[model samples]
Target chain A: MSRALDRTGIWIGWAFFADLANALALTFGYMFSRPVTMQYPDKEKWLPYSRYRGHHFLKRDDEGEIKCVACELCARICPCYCIEVIPYEDEKGNRHPAKFEIDMARCLFCGLCEDACPADAIALGQQYEFSSFSSRDLVIGRDDLLGKPGKAATGGGVVSARLNTEQDVLVETSEPQGYNWWRNIRRT
Target chain B: MELVVALGLIVFKVALLIAILLLLPLPLTWLERKVAGHMQQRMGPMRVGWHGLLQPVADGIKLLTKEDHIPAEADRFLFKLAPILALAPPFVVFVAVPFGESVSVLGTEITLYVSNMNVALLFVFAVIGIEVYGVIFGGWAANSKYAVLGSLRTCAQMISYEIPMGFAVIGVVMLAQSMSLLEIVRAQADVWNIVYQPVGFFVFFVAGLAESQRIPFDLAEAEGDLGAGFHTEYSGIRFAFFMVSEYAIMLLTSVLAVILFFGGWNGVLVPLPPLLWFVLKVAFFVYVFIWFRFTFPRYRYDQLMAIGWKVLLPLSMANIIITGVAFL
Candidate 1:
């Protein structure tokens, strides 16, 4: 009986003080600690990674010429079938795309298009904020893909000026051929 | 003319108190979310307006606009009455709550409280006891098994906890030698009751958590098992009413705890006014409530009963005996 009473006393003491102390300690610890939220849209605006695949853009050569041989490899390899490359013979007898359209509404952003491109013409750009008002606005045509200067796409797809800022920072240095391809395209 | 003027003053005071009672929950809900968020190392709401200051406003509007859904087999009259029943008890309890010392305004001494009863403690307990009926009725009228089970749990939890809670108060009443909340505050002018009856205070605080059906004791509305418990069938503004009452009772108990233990509005060597001191004390207890909700996991139903019965009740009874002997 005495042992039971002693055990009860110990249990009660532990329950009262230990629980209160633990709660108070945790509360104060959390109060003093820095909040972990990123406060998105305003602060911490850096892109995720160098190789992070996002919106697709068509490349231009140093002389302001389209580099795509319109091999249709991207269209073939695309799991979502979002890319369409219509190859036609140009005035220089070189096969180029007459129309390059990517239904971004269907894009998986898998970076497969970038990997499959033989001429290094189509590459994924680092732009993730792409909410569109309509599905039609999501379809990127030849001029939009070519990074033309004037027309602003309604969806938060990266514009030419913004793309220029991200170009040097995001392109992987290990891929010398892709890096040189991107460098030559931006010179004009 | 004097009678008319007194009646008018009473009416005005009641209206003002009702408005405050109704509106306090809006900001409180937002505060609870923010506190819970910060405690967990995450920011709660930041989208609606400047750090989600307008979140409660948005929530109020959304609740108001939602379809008022009633289950097909529900007892419509009882279902409709339950939310109002839940809401009324807290306001009634607040009538006897003395917030601060009287101040003379325009040559008329005005008390901050709505009504000062000689048996204020009894009045608070009796009115608050009626609140469980709302839960039970809400559950029974819903005609669902989960709702019935939830209300049954609540009924048992609340009824069991009230014993320890009442005993804790009895210890304080014995110490103060008065039942009036105002008089209790006055008794603690020299020193707070918490200094004398720390055990009583601890017991009361724990019991108060169960009484308010807060987390760790919130088996009634345990989302995992009962699906929002008693208020499962309630929707839209009706659901908002139930939620508001839960917060109101929480505030009331915290305020009561302040008056009972912390010496409401009584501060030494403080330049701040008595009302501010009282409010700050109440706010501290309220923060503690939110902190506990965030930190502790919910208690299993049997463990909750065991704590209330085998732990708090016996402890409070011992505290009363100790206080009585010390007084002798």
Candidate 2:
């Protein structure tokens, strides 16, 4: 009798209960709560206390000069090796990089490259909506690679520890990805 | 003046629920894409709205503008009729769902529901059962073996699950002593059906999932094997209607579960209002469904059937017996 019960009884019990419970819980418990979506550019997303990580861009100087000295530190430090920089001499014998490229596709946003940069040239900025039609479009040139100086980063890879509060930095340190799987999992 | 105001409030409440439910599926589709994208370590739907919130809207417009294609060999009437028939039945079900209790509207009493039939529960079940006809017709009209087979599988799965679902709901009816959903909810003022009949809750939940044709039970549109399943030939706004119906059913099932198991907005202390608590509970289950969709792989057709038959049906029958004995 127990065996029969276990086979048929258990299955039927779960079928009925789980279905009703799931439905009830969603409708009564959470569905009617204010939907978490905010109208973007018009309304700000209350993104759980400084967890918003925007697009990855390198930092620029106050005078709008590219901070990335083409030090090749970002390239060397990148795990995916998506970053490529060519340090060349100009006609005036200026030892600046002739070609600088950062492939956004392969970037892990690990921020190690920013950390490795000696000149404080590379910084991942806020502006996470980096979308493109082709792989070629996603690859950032030297001019596009840099972040704005002294700007409040909405949150993403390689944010300045100074701009963020201690707790925010601590959280960021704990979760290097900034937006882990859990935070992004919005329950509909 | 009082009657007009009361009627207006009822209309407003029903409209609000319908509007919210209708808009929900679009975001669900977007979220599915984003979740799938992140899971695969690739960004999905980056362009349209911020993080693709507007992606569904774009898709809606795009689908609407697309050409409606019907094969020459297909039965023209049913081909045109299939998606609509498939779509309309589920959409019609919200008429009976009680979203909240009556409140004073312009000094006139009003109910939060559109319909208050004594047989509301039966009406919902009967309507849902008829939804299969939509699928069958669509499949038969398509003139493709794949579509026919897909529809047949869907019919079998939906019909098989409905048994356990119906039985599970019976347990709640026994306790509430009424088939009327509002009365059932009102019956659980002190104790929820869930506290006494957990087994019934489980059976109903699984059956509901299958009924919604969600993941783990979504053999209806098994893309890899069925190539969009029964609606393979459907296009344009017609296809959109089918999609809308699917999400609507999902929302409806969620609402039903809340009503039956979770005390249906009956709490010890009504601090923040019962309605608020009700919505929170419903959202939790919706998230779980989303979570399941994200986390689990689709079940094979045979395995799904075996589980429904060998497992859910019998278990629900026993649960009814258990509930009966416990009450006695």
Candidate 3:
């Protein structure tokens, strides 16, 4: 933003002082400013807001059991045909999935499955970090998708959390982290 | 017996100076990275050792342990010697750099400096000028085109800037009426040379930046282009030597500026030890040099030439004339 061939004494003094002052001010300003990087699984784990369609989580009743009625509405609505469900009746007349399978590799992470669930049992929850080693791991079964992993999927927008190393989960702290990228990505 | 003791003292001083010079680059590396990081609104280096305090030491260890790689077509002899040549002059330059006046220890006086010849200022400049050969040799020895170009740029840049850098100090020399750096400091006991020769100080600093191959004027080893410049083919300890010498040159510039313009060992406000004042002033000047690295952009080759010859050269020349007229 400066010029060359300015041999005037006044120009030298003004340019030098002005530039120095500007640089010093900026340097000091940034020096004290906070960095906008997420530590992630080191110091703080990110908690995606509600309505985020990350990994699938089966909704639970008050007693913390699956709310799925084996209605097969989610299987019918899935665009990718990634879900499979087999219906059976309990002695109490409650309906449940005898064989439920989801091929995560083929799933598009669309919220249609959550919307079509009449029982409000199946949902694409905000549990994003579910990456595993092999193709077999991508094909999750009832045991894999049952209990909601990590923190309770109930926070909004953005949250920071202390890492729970032993169970490999996030312990949400009271600090109240702020930033939002919820549903920023959409599947056409 | 007396002569033996005198010779022993000289050897002891040389040993001490070398140790200090070798260790100087450790904290300097940490400071430069830390400053650059903070200015850019990021944590600089925190992993290695608390804010990367042990980073340079770790770097030195890495360099030391790395395989010594040499290009197949390179001049092997010159390649080995270049780093030593580059490294020795800055070490030698310290001979004339007076840290403080003689301090007595148990009835025996020991000078803070290794040696102080009457022509100490001249000696310092002349020795520093020789470091260009080290850089030139490094580039030429590598037998690479980019290395050659980098070396040539270094040679030309130093030659052009050296004139102004040398002349900038003439104002201080004239005002002090002595070429000895110690005497120059003594002359500025009450009033610093910076008051009389602001232009000279400016010229000296700018030219010194160029001389040291610091960031703004660091065309020789410009990391962006030319594949790391002259020391491109160099690796391990040899490359580390070049790096250390560069830091040493920057340190020398700060030390010289303090001795010449800012009044070395002369405290302003509070009463403190002379060495402390000298160190504190030198530290401030060194920080300014690092500040310039992060603050300003690198100059284009032609722009570098223009600044060196057109602006600084003439400014320093005019400074000399003005100082002469004022003296007369």
Candidate 4:
């Protein structure tokens, strides 16, 4: 009678307990599976997609002369009313801004200003760091935005230079980095 | 002089046990984070010390230095007492826990546990139950909606699962014919209680998970929706106290499982010391709990209740009946 009872108990456990056991086994297998988190800044900075909109910077020609004509097309088209421009014309007929400023605190980052600019002169740069402790500091001028792509700046910084290709050179969120990139991080 | 020496030994044992229990959470937190990190194939807490071994020390210092804030609307008295209530009971439960058989030192015999009451299991259950009051008081005192809801869930969850947990223990009690934890371990000399009471162990495991407010049953820690649940108002040392209670409770559950089922300190095959075997077994279960935390998603509130009341309670009742009849 006791043997029969024991058999029934085993059958009950076998039928009912298999699913929980199966789940545990499956997850235990994944204990050795690859972690997808790419440690940013300390490791690989996620380079934004080409044509990715970030902080703005003024363009320069070959002689390092500022390319902005002070036509104020970007300032006019800005949706957030964050841009301020004071046009200046040099004695030699060179056109530039006397005091050009964009309050990044208020700016929408819509990339519309990039589209409005003539020949992409006041185009948005690949720099991502725009935060400042004070609102006064956030109102960036033309000089502050020139040739600076923040600290993660390596070729074109966090933003890609060229448009994205079929085989993505820039690591997009869609792909998991299954390489030995983490090994390069020197143990502190 | 003899009486004084005996009194001194008791005091020494109590102090040592308290110190060990208090310090245990540091290693446990480190182990938990490492387990979680590795289970997901990442290194957790590697910055502070070697493999994040000193991470808990860094965290303790950080928590200690933080600003202590109490909301203006909160009940000041209950808010102060809540974390204490939560933390103290788990330690109190330790007084009755049978670590192993006695050891002789300097010609004086010293038992491992502080006290081994004949009804130690009952004492453990009864005292540990008081831990919920801490949750309730903390939630009610916070004067926040999330805190209250979190506390209510913890209360209902504990009350519901406590029944099945009781039944699970009853099966072991019936099999061993004793309520003492040490006696229960002694009963499982030749064969572990797991072989005879598999269903009891299953029920106990499920209910213990709920009791500790762990994953799948940790609907109370509704970080997703309830914004840290009952601890939304807590910060710094106050929060640390609650965390200490949580780790202690997890340890307590692991210890119980070892004593009740796995033949406490009974070595198998390898001739390792009994204390080492016992510690290894407890460590294994602790890892299993951490494994479960990462492995399973939190059950919905309704699902948690359903499992507690509809599933485990009935299952444990059946287990009790079967164990009784089989033994007879």
DockQ of each: 0.44, 0.04, 0.45, 0.35
Q: Is candidate 1 or candidate 4 better by lDDT?
A: 1
Q: Which ten residues in a row have the lowest lDDT in candidate 1 chain B?
A: B38-47
Which lDDT values do the candidates have, in the order given? 0.84, 0.75, 0.84, 0.83
Model 4: how far residue B275 lies from native, Å: 2.2
The numbered model that scores best in DockQ is 3
- Is 1 or 2 the stronger prediction by lDDT? 1
In model 2, how large is the Cα lDDT of residue B155? 94
**TM-scores for every predicted model:** 0.88, 0.64, 0.84, 0.78
lDDT of 2 by residue, A38-108 (tens): 33333222222233334456665687655556768778878999888898765755456667787888787
Runs in model 4 with CA error above 4 Å?
A1-15, A43-46, A85-92, A149-154, A158-188, B33-55, B58-82, B102-110, B132-153, B219-239, B297-306
Q: Which residue pairs overlap in candidate 3's backbone?
A: none
Sort the candidates on lDDT, descending order: 3, 1, 4, 2
- lDDT tens digits, residues B1-328, model 2? 9789767766787678668767888888987776555544455686686878899999989998999888789999888877777776776777887867876758856676787778889989999887888788888898988889889989999999999999989899999989988999999988988898788888888889898888878899988898787888788888887788888788778889999998877766656677887887887777667766655568998899898998888989998888889789
Candidate 1: chain B TM-score against the reference chain B: 0.98
Q: State the RMSD for candidate 1.
A: 7.4
Clashes of 2: 61
Docking class of 4: acceptable
lDDT of 2: 0.75
Task: Flag regions of model 2 displaced more than 4 Å.
Answer: A1-188, B1-18, B35-43, B268-270
Per-residue CA lDDT of candidate 4, range A7-38, in tens?
99888877786657877887677666666556
- What TM-score, to 2 decimals, does candidate 2 have? 0.64
